[model samples]
Target: MITLKNVTLRRSAKVLLDNASVTLNPGEKVGLVGRNGAGKSSLFALLNGTLHEDGGDYYIPAQWRMGQVAQEMPETDQSATDFVVEGDTTLVAAQAEVRAAEATDDFERMAHAYMELHDAGAHDAPARAQALILGLGFKTTELTNPVNSFSGGWRMRLQLARALMCPSDLLLLDEPTNHLDLDALVWLEAWLKRYEGTLVVISHDREFLDAVTNVTLHIDAGKLVRYGGNYSKFEDMRAEQMELQQAAFGKQQDKIAHLQKFIDRFKAKASKAKQAQSRVKALERMEKIAPMLADADFSFEFKEPANLPNPMLSMSGASFGYPPPEDAPAGTPPTVIVQHVNRSVLAGQRIGILGANGQGKSTLVKTVARALAPIGGELTEGKGLNIGYFAQQELDVLRPLDTPLEHMIRLVRETAARGQNHGQGTREQDLRSFLGMFNFGGDMVKQAVGSMSGGEKARLVLCMIVWQRPNLLLLDEPTNHLDLATREALSMALNEFEGTVMLVSHDRALLRAVCDEFWLVTRGGVEPFDGDLDDYQRYLLDEAKRQRESLKESLKEPVAATTKIAESEAPKGATGTFSLKNAPAQRKLDAQRRQQHADKARPIKRELEGCERRMAELTQEKARIEAQLATPLAPAAIAETGKRLKAVGDELHALEERWLELTEEIEHTAGA
Candidate 1:
C-alpha cells in the first residue's frame, strides 16, 4: 500500500500537482488519466520516487517492496531472459555463489552457500523466471537471445515481465499497454486484475482501464479527483458533474449580468447609487464559475472541401506487396503480400483498414493516398479529389526550428501560394481551436516543435492536417499518443465529418466507432468484410465453432477412411486363398495411395493445430468481453467492447477459411 498525502509537485514554476492526495490499497487498480501535459506520468514518477515533489508527504509501508516499469529499457549486458531473471537479484547472486561452491567441491563453502540460497528461495528462481518469460510471450529458446537484438517494443515487454516476476508490495506502470499487442494486453489485464499487490498505472488504454481498475484517478486543471469504479463509470460521473457545473456557471453568469444592468441604469440616482456601488462590488467579488471546457465561439467549423459526385478514390484489382525486384537473380522469388484489393472510397464513406501490425494496412492507405505506388493495380481518381494524408510517422517530418504556430503559418502560406486562401481568418482561428482541442494553448503554440513531447508533436501535426480541409482524409495510426478524452473527441468529430476517410489503426474501438466499413489486409489479399464490428465478431464466433468441428472431423478422417479402404481392397484369391505375389501391383498402388494420404495428413494436422490456437484465442476474447459487459458500460467502454469483439470475429473467420481449404485438400488427396 502506498499513499500520497497532499502532494505538491512543481517544475519550472508550473504546478504539476497541487495538494493532490491519493491512496493505493492492496489489490487496487487505478488508471491515471488526463489531457496532455496534465502531469499524469509526472505523478507516477513522484510516487515511484524517481521525481520528488516540491512539498508533499509520500508514504508506503516500511517493509513493502516496490517495482516500477521504466519507459525505456535500462542498459545491461545480459540476454533478455537473463535480464528478466536478474529481477530477483539477491536470490540470483546467492544461487550463483552456491553453484560456484558446488563446482569447486568446497564442502564448507557449498554447505554455507546452499543454506543461504535455500533460505532466500534462490532454488525456485529458475522456475519463476521460466514462467514469467512464457507469460510475456517469449519462447523458451528466446531466453538466451541478446537483449539488444530485440526491438524497443519487445524490450518493454521484457521490462514488464521482469517487474511482474519480482513480487512487490506495489507496482507502478506508465503506459504499460503502449507497445502490447491485443493478446499481451489481455494477458496483462487479467494478471493485474488477479494480482494481490497494489497497482497504480498511467495509461490511455480505455478498455484496459475499464477491465482492470476499480477506481479512476483523474488529474485535470491542476486538480486530482478520485472517482469510484472503472474508467467508464468515472466518465459517466464526470459528465454528470460537468452538466451540473455548466448549469451553475450559466445561472451565476446570468445573475451577474442582470446585476450589472441594474447598476448601470440606476447609478445616477443618489438613493440607488450606494446600492448600485454595493452590487458592483458584490459582482466583482463573485467568483464567476469558470465555464466548462467546451467549444468556444472562436472555434471554426471543420468542413471538408467540396468535390464532384462519386468517390474521391477508387481501386480496381489493386495489389500490394514487398516483392523483390524483377531484376533480381534467378534463384530469388518475390512474396505476394496482398492481391486483388478492389475497393471504392465514396464521398462520404468512412472505411477502416484492419490487420496485424505488418500486414500492409498502412501500405494500402499510402497507395490510395498516392504516397506509394501500387505493385499492380488500376486506381482511378475522381474529379476534384483532394486528399489530406496523415502518416503514422508524420511527426518526424516537422521542422525542428519551427514552433507549432510557425508550422500552421507555413501551411497557410502554402495554401495561399496555391491561390486557395479562401478563408485565412477561418483557417487561423480553426488552427488555434484545434490546437486547444489537443491541449496545446497559447504558450504551447509558441513552443518550438523540438521542445514538445511526442504526444504534443503528434497532436500539432494532426491539427495542421485538419486545417487543410481535404475531402479525403487518409490517416494511419492517428490515435497513437492521444489521451482518452482527445481520442473520443476526434472519433466523434470524424464520425460527424462529411468526407471520405480511410484509416489504418490498431485501436479497434476508434475504428468501429468512426468507420462505416472495415477491410482486412492479409497475406493473400485485402478482403472486405461486409458489416460493422459487431457483425464481424458474430461471424468470428460462428467460424470458430465451424473450425473446431472441422478439425475434429479431419482427425477422424484418416483412420475411418483407411479402415474402409482396407475392407474394400480385401484380396479374393482362387481356391479361397490370398496370394501376395499375384496382388503385388494392387498392393503397390495401395501403398502409394497411403503415402499420399500421409503426406496430406501432415499439412492438415498443422492446419488443425493453428485452428485450435485461433479458437483458444477467440474464446479468451469472448471471456474478456463477458467480463467487461458484467461491469458498468460507459459509451467509451461499449465502443471498446464492440471493437474487440469485431477483431476476435475477424481472426476466427480467417482461421475457419484456412481450415476449410486444408480439409478440402485432405479429402481430395485421400480419394486418390
Candidate 2:
C-alpha cells in the first residue's frame, strides 16, 4: 500500500495537484481521469519518482517498489525480449556473475552464487517471462523477433508487458490500452481483476477502467476528488451532487437579488442599512457552484452504402495463416498458419470476432482483405462488393508529413480522377465536413498527421472510411486508443453504417452494445455463432458454470448448504417476548450456513491464493528462463529446454483458467 500526503505539484504558473491526499491499498483498482493536458501523466511520473514536485510533499513507503508504464519508450536497438529483461538489469548482471562463478569451478564462490541464484529463482524466470509474453498477446514465434520490427503500437504493448511483469507494490499505467487489440485488452482486464497489488492507471478507455477499477479519482481545479465505485457509478453520484449544488446556488442567487433590491430602496434607513450590509457580507462569503464539464453533443451520421450481393467473401476448405519463407525455392508453398477453415461473409451483417491473441485472427482478416492471398482454399469476392479495410495499425498508412487537409484533398483528387465522385470541389467539402463532425475543425484539420494522438489518427481514418462508404468494412481493433466519448460516437456511427461490418474488438461492453453476430476465431478455426456479443458471453458463462457443477457432482460429497439465521430477530429493545424455544433451529441454521460457506468459501479462497502464488511463481520462472537462455547454449539444448519450458507454460495456463473460474464463482456467490 502507498499513501500521498499533502502532495502539491505545480508548473511555472499553474497548479496541478494542490494539497492532494490519497491512500491506495492493495487489491484496489483506481482510475485517475481528467481532461486533455490536465497533468494525468505528470501525476503518474510524480508517483513513480520520475518527476520532481514544486511544492508540498509526495510520500511513498520506503520498502515499496513502484513500476510505471510511460507513454513513450527509449529508442533502443535491441530485441523486445532484451528490452523487457532489462527491466531488472541488476538481477540480470547478478545472474551473469553467478553463471561465471559456476563455469570457473570455484566451489566456495559457486556455492554462494548458487544460493543467490536459487533464492532469486533465476532458473525459472523464462517460464514466467513466456507467460507474461503470451498473456500480453505475443506468440512464441515472435519472442526472439527484433523490437524494431514492430510498429509503435506493438512496441507500446511490449513496454506494458514489462511493467506488468515487474515486481511492484504500486503500478502506474498511463494509457496502457492504447496499443492493445481487443484480445490483449480482455486478457489484461482479467489479469488486473485478480491483481493483488495496488494500481492507479490513467486511461481514456472507460470499459477498461470500469472492468478493473473500484474507485474513480477525478482531478479537477487542482484538486483530487475520490468517488466510490466504477466509472458509471461515479457519474450517477456526480450528477445527483451537481443537481443539489445547482438548487442551492439558485436559492442563494435569489436571496442576493432580493437583498440588493432592499438596499436600493432602503439603504439610507438606519435599520435597513445594517441589515443590507449583513446580507452583502453573507452573499460575498458564499462560494459559487462549479459547473460540471460535459462532453459536446456530437453525433455522426454515416453515408449509407448501396446494397450489394450476398456472400461478400467466402472461403471453401480454406486456410487462414501466414507462411514463413523457406530456405530453398522462390515458388514453394508458404507455411500454413490456419488450415481447414470454411466461412462466408454476407451483406447486411455486422460480425464480431472473438479469440485469444496469436490465434490467426489478423491472418483471417488479411486473407479476406486480399492483403495476403490464402495459401490454400478458394476465397471469392461477390459481384458488386466493395471493401474497405481498417487495419489495427492504420496509422502507418498516414503520410506523417501530410496535413489532415492535404491527405483528405489528395484522397479526394485520386477518387475523383477515377471518375467516381460527384466532383473534386464537392468531395473536398464533404471531407472537410466529415472531419468537422469528428471534432477536427479549422486549424486542427491542417495539423500534420504526425502530430496527432493515436485516437485522433484513428478517428481521421474512420472519417476517410465513411467518406468512401464501402459496402463492406473490415475493422481491426478500431477502438484501441479511443476514449469513452469517442468510442461511443464511433459505435453509433457503425450501428447506423448501412453496410456489412466485420470487426475485432476486445471491449466487451462496446461489443455487447454494438455487434449483432459473432465470429469466434479460436486457435483451431473460426466458428460463427448466431447471436450478439452479450449472448455469446452469457453462453460462455453458462458453459463454465456447467463445467463447475459437473465437477462438483462428480465429487459426490454431501456438503451442507450454508445459510445464516440470526437469533433474537426482533427489534434491539423490543418489549415483546424473545423466545429461546427456537434456539436449536437457529443453531442448526447457523451450522448449515457455516458448513455451506466452508464448502464454497475454502475452495474460492484457496484458488485465489493459488492464483497469486502461481503469478509469483510464473514471474520468477520467466526471469530465470530469460537468464538461462541468454547464455551461449547449443541449439539442441535450447530446443529441448524450450519443450520442457512449454510444459511448465501449459501448466501455468491451466492454473490461470482455474483461477478465473474460482474468482468468478466467488463473485457470483457473493452477489447471490
Candidate 3:
C-alpha cells in the first residue's frame, strides 16, 4: 500500500498538492489525469522519491520495489538487449553477489549466490528483454544493434522496454504511448492488462486510459481526487459535480442551448448525413459533459473554405516514397513504401489512415502534402484544391527563429501574391488579433517558435491551417502534444468544419469521433479498411502473432511439425474450443454468418438509440424544470412542474434500464 496523509507538495514556491490525503492499494491499475502543468508529473516525482513532501507524511511499503522508464536518453553503444537486461537490478545484484562469493572463496556463499541468480531468471534475461523490445516495435534483427544507432523516439522505446524488463511490485509509466504507433500501443495495452503489479500511468489519451485503467486519479486545483472507475467514468462523475455547482454550470447553459438549436435546425438539412451525424453525436455528448470542456484555455475553429472541390485529389497507379540517394548509381531505383495506390479524396470525406509503423502511413500523407513526389505514375488535383498540411514533426513546417506574427504575416503575403481572397486580414493589427485567437496574445505573438512547448507549437500549426481556409487537410499525428481539453476542442472543431479531412493518429478517441471511414496502408499497397477500430485492433494483434510465429520459424532448426503447441495457443474456455485469438482462418467466418449476427443486432441497436434520444429529452426537460423551480413561481405552477419532473424521472429510469438490456443483448449477439 502507498499512503499520503496530509501531504503538502511544492515545486519551488508553487504548491502542487496541499493537505492531500490518498491511499493507493497494491495491484491497482490507475490512470492519473490532469490538465498540462497541473502537477501530474510533480505527483509522479513525489511517488518515485525524487521529491519529498514539503509537509506531513508519505509512505510506501518498505519491501515494495518500484519500476519506471528512464527519462534521460541513452547514448551508449551497448546492444539493445544488453541495455534492457541491465535494467533488472535484481539480476545484477545476484550476479554481483556471486562474484563477491567467488573472490572470498566461501563455498556456502557461492552456492547461495548461484541459487539467487537462477531464481532471478538470469539465464533467460536476454530472451525476456528481447520480447519486451519487440513488443515495443523493434525488429528482431535490431535486437543486437548498438543502442546509439537508433533515433530519439526509438531510444525512448528502448528505455520503456528496459522499464518493463525489470521485476517490481509497482510500475509507473508517464506518456508511454506518446512514441508508439497503433501496433505498438495495442501490444503495450495487452502487456499492462496482464501486469501483476500496481500500475500508475499519466496520459492524455482517453481510449488508452479506458482500455488499461480500472481506477482513475485526478489532480484539480491543488487537490487530489480519486475515482472508482476509468476515464469515462471520471468524466461522468465530474459532469455531475459541475451540474451541482449551479453558479458555474449557469455560465455555459446558453452556449449548450445554442448548440442544441443548431443541431435541431441543421441535422435535417445536412448535405452529407453520414458525415454530419458525427456532429450531432458530438453535440449530444457535449451537452451531457458541458461546462467542464467549456473551460479549456484554447478553443478555435477552421473557417469554411472559399470553394469546395468535389474530388479533391485523385491518384492512379501511384508509388509514394523517397527518391534515391543522389550519390547512388544512375540506374538505382527510388524507395517505394506504398505502391499502386489508386484512390480518390472526395470532398466532405473524413478519413482515418490506419497501419503499423514503417508501413507508409506518413509516406502517403507526405506525398499528398507535396513533400514528396510519386516514384512512378500520376496524381491529379481538382481545381481550387487548397491544401493545409500538418507534418508529424512540428519543426518540419516551422522556422525555429521565426515568431508567430512573422509566420502569419508571411501567409497573408503569400495569399495576396497568389491573388486570392479567402477573407484573411491583411493588416498587422488584424494578423495579431488572429494569432490571439489561438492563445498567442501580446508578447506571446513575439515569442520565438523554438522557445515554446510542444503544445504551443501544435497550436501554431493549427492556427496556420485555419488561416489558409484550405478545402483539403492532410494531418499526421496532429494531437501528439495537445492536452485532453484541446483535443476535445479540436474534435468539436473538426466536426463543424466544412471541408475534407485525412488524419493519421494513434488517438482512438479522436479517430472514432472524426473519421467516417478508414484507409489501411499495409504491405505495399493501400485499400479501404472494411471495419471499425475494434476490428482493426483485433487485426493488428493477429498480425503481430503472425510476425512472432514467422520469426520463431526462422530461428529454429528444421524439425518435424510434431512440436508441442505453445501455451498461448492452447484450448480456451471450459468448452475446449481452440484458441481463436491468434487463428486468423478460424476467426474469419463466412459473410453469411456475420450478416445474420448483424441482422439480430440491428433491431436492438435501433431500440437502444431510441431510448437514448428519449433519455436526452427527459434529462433536458428535468434540468429546465429544475431551473424553473429554482426561481420565484406561483404555488400551482411549481406543483405542476414538480409533478412533471417526477414523471420524467420515472420514464427516464425505465428507459435507461431498457437501454442497458438492449446494449447487453446486442453485444451478446455480436459475440455469438
Highest lDDT against the true fold, candidate: 3
lDDT of 1 by residue, 1-672 (tens): 677888888877899889888776777878888876789877877766778978878887887778777566766668765688678756667768866865764555654564455456543455567567655656544665787877766788888888887767778888777766444565577678888887888877766788888989988777788898987678667656765766555654654454344334433322333222333332232212112223211222346575644867678997765557779988675555677878777877767776544567777777777776777878899977777777776554588778887888788788778766535365667777667865679888888888777677767766776777778888887766777656655654565467787887656556655565677675567877665544554554465467557546645676456534543566766865545665778777767766766776777767777887877878687667657756766645554454455456556655655664565566555555
- The C-alpha RMSD of each candidate to the native structure, in angstroms, is 16.9, 18.8, 21.3
Backbone clash tally for model 2?
19
Q: Write the per-residue lDDT of candidate 2 for residues 526-545, one digit (tens) a residue.
A: 78765554455566556546
Cα lDDT over the full model 1: 0.67
Displacement of the residue 319 alpha carbon in candidate 3, Å? 0.5
lDDT of 3: 0.82
Sort all candidates by TM-score, best to worst.
3, 1, 2
lDDT of model 2 at position 559:
31
Model 1 residue 282 CA deviation (Å) reads 43
Q: What TM value does model 2 have?
A: 0.63
Candidate 2 positional error at 568, Å: 66
lDDT-best of 1 and 3: 3
Candidate 3 residues 1-672, lDDT tens each? 999999999999999999988899999999999888889999899889898999989999989999999999999999898899999999999879867865874555655565566568764577689889989998765777899999999999999999998899999999998899998999899999999999999988998999999999999888889999999889989989988888977887776665555446545554454434554465566666766776566678889899898899999999999998999999888998999988999998989999999999999999999999988888999999999999999999998899999999888888889987778777899989999898899899999999999889999999999999999999999988998989988887887778999999999888877787889999899999877787899899888888667534422311111122222234586667665565665445433455566576667667776888898888888778768767876555654554465467557756755664565465456445
For candidate 1, list the clashing residue pairs, or say none.
540-649
lDDT score for residue 338 of model 1: 73
Better of 2 and 3 by lDDT: 3
- Tell me the deviation in Å of residue 648 in model 1: 42
Whole-model alpha-carbon lDDT for candidate 2:
0.66
